[model samples]
Target: MAMHPLSDTDIGDIHSQLRELRTEHHDLDLVIAHLIDNPPPDELLIRRLKKRKLLLKDRIFLLEQMLVPDIPA
Candidate 1:
């Protein structure tokens, strides 16, 4: 199956989503760090947060790739 190219609006929307995901990923990092600093942190919560952060990282990478044009050699 062939994929359609993104329009200007679609690209803009993707950029916006990328920014939000990056911000959330950074925020999660801070929260995880803080939680670790406190004694006897909730292991379950930390694990969940780590999982979410990983997912966001993946999404961010995908969006970034979409922004780049493919060149034929």
Candidate 2:
């Protein structure tokens, strides 16, 4: 299906979401690092956090792509 062009509001919303997701992703990175450095870390928790971070990264990438208008070469 063809995609509709994003309006100013839509772009603004996406920007807001991107900011939130990026912040969360960064926070998760710090948390993961902290968890790893401390004594024995909980593998399960770390794995779950990493998975969540990956999902956030994917979402951030998709939103960023949306902001870029498609141009015919």
Candidate 3:
């Protein structure tokens, strides 16, 4: 599928969004680690955070791919 041309502002916006997502993902990693390392009383919260982290990972991958044009092998 062909993507529409993006203006400079659009690229910048995506970059900003990417950074925000990465930061949030990293924070989630820390939180999950702390929760597991300390063995929190609520396992459900940890599970939710893990699930959210997985989703953020997927979104990050997708955005990165969008920025990098694929080359024909």
Candidate 4:
């Protein structure tokens, strides 16, 4: 799909959001690893973190999809 016309500021904002999402995903990975290493982990916390990670993944996918150029077939 062709990307909508985004102002410089809009592009900047999307980049910033993408960065934050990646950082958050990395942090979640650490949390998941720590939980796995420790027995009797907090199930609720792990569940919440996983949900947040999934949300970030979805957002990143959307942003990436927006960046893809539409090809004429």
Candidate 5:
């Protein structure tokens, strides 16, 4: 997936988003770890964090898809 068509601003935006997503993922990891260590987690908080992690995963997937050009048959 070539990035030539993307303008500088577009590339910058994507980079920024990726960074933010990574940061969020890292934070979630810490939370999950803490829950593991402490035991007896709050169901609601766990569910919410898992949902957010999935959402971020989807966003990252879409961003990656944007880099790939569609092939015609």
Candidate 6:
């Protein structure tokens, strides 16, 4: 969905959300690594975690784009 031009407050809120998503994404990275490092890892749980991480990554990218104004060439 295309968001309308955001007010400063809205942008701030978005920025906060971006930080939270990034933190979660980083935590997921650690969790995923631990899951892989342990023997007899639960493949199903790892797969789910990986999928969640991907989704969070996508959201982070989108929010970053929204926060940064694109420069025209």
* lDDT score, candidate 4, position 26: 97
Indicate the residue-level lDDT of 67 in model 3: 82
List lDDT for all candidates, in order: 0.93, 0.96, 0.86, 0.86, 0.81, 0.90
Q: Per-residue lDDT for 60 in model 2?
A: 99
Give the better candidate number (1 or 6) by lDDT: 1
User: Per-prediction TM-score, please?
Assistant: 0.91, 0.94, 0.86, 0.81, 0.78, 0.86
RMSD of 2: 1.2
lDDT per residue (tens digit) for residues 1-73 in model 6: 4556778998999999998999999999999999899978999999999999999999999888888765555
- Model 1 Cα displacement at 42 (Å)? 0.7
lDDT of 2 by residue, 7-62 (tens): 99999999999999999999999999999999699899999999999999999999
* Superior by TM-score: candidate 4 or candidate 5: 4
* TM-score top scorer: 2
Clashing pairs in 3: none
2-73, model 1: which lDDT tens digit per residue? 357889999999999999999999999999999999979989999999999999999999999888776655
| lDDT tens digits by residue: candidate 4, 38-70 | 988988999999999999999999876665556
List the lowest-lDDT window of 10 residues for candidate 3.
Answer: 64-73
Better of 3 and 6 by lDDT: 6
**What is the lDDT for 13 in model 6?**
91
Poorest 10 consecutive residues by lDDT, candidate 1: 1-10
Question: How accurate locally is residue 27 in candidate 6, as Cα lDDT from 0 to 100?
Answer: 98
Q: How many backbone clashes does candidate 4 have?
A: 0
Ranking according to lDDT, highest score first:
2, 1, 6, 3, 4, 5
Residue-level error in angstroms, candidate 5, position 64: 1.8
Query: On lDDT, who's better, 4 or 6?
Result: 6
